[model samples]
Target: MEKLEEQIAHLTRTVEDLSDVVARQDQEIALLTRRVALLLEREASREAEGTGGVVLGDERPPHY
Candidate 1:
């Protein structure tokens, strides 16, 4: 009975540790997702501006 209790305690600790790891990963994923969204918005704004006015990718010279 004592051995069973020890096994249960170890399992409980392992589950708690895994839960913490998952929580941290979830937070990181949320942060990374927000960053990616911001980056995408910035890129889109740049592309829109480039299309509206100047092309920054060296497509041609101003004289041509």
Candidate 2:
């Protein structure tokens, strides 16, 4: 029937739209994951070097 065909078409369009959204979300999540990994690696390297780059509020500036 025509009504059944119309319903099928509508459902198909909805599924396709949802699929596109999911694909885009997957890409964004992948990019963010990579960025987090790189940041962690950089922090680890800095810590391993044992540089006192961290300063406290009470500490005077090295320029002084």
Task: Please tell me which predicted candidate would have the highest TM-score against the true structure.
Answer: 1
lDDT winner among the candidates?
2
26-53 per-residue lDDT for model 1 (tens digits)? 9999999999999989889988788535
Model 1 TM-score, all chains together = 0.78
For model 2, residues 11-64, the per-residue Cα lDDT tens digits are 999999999999999999999999999998988889999862889999998899
How do all models score by TM-score? 0.78, 0.75
Backbone clashes per model, in order?
A: 0, 0
Compared with the true structure, model 2 gives a TM-score of: 0.75
Q: Point out the worst 10-residue segment of candidate 1 by lDDT.
A: 49-58
The list of candidate 2 runs beyond 4 A from truth reads: 52-64
- The whole-model C-alpha lDDT of candidate 2 against the native structure comes to 0.94
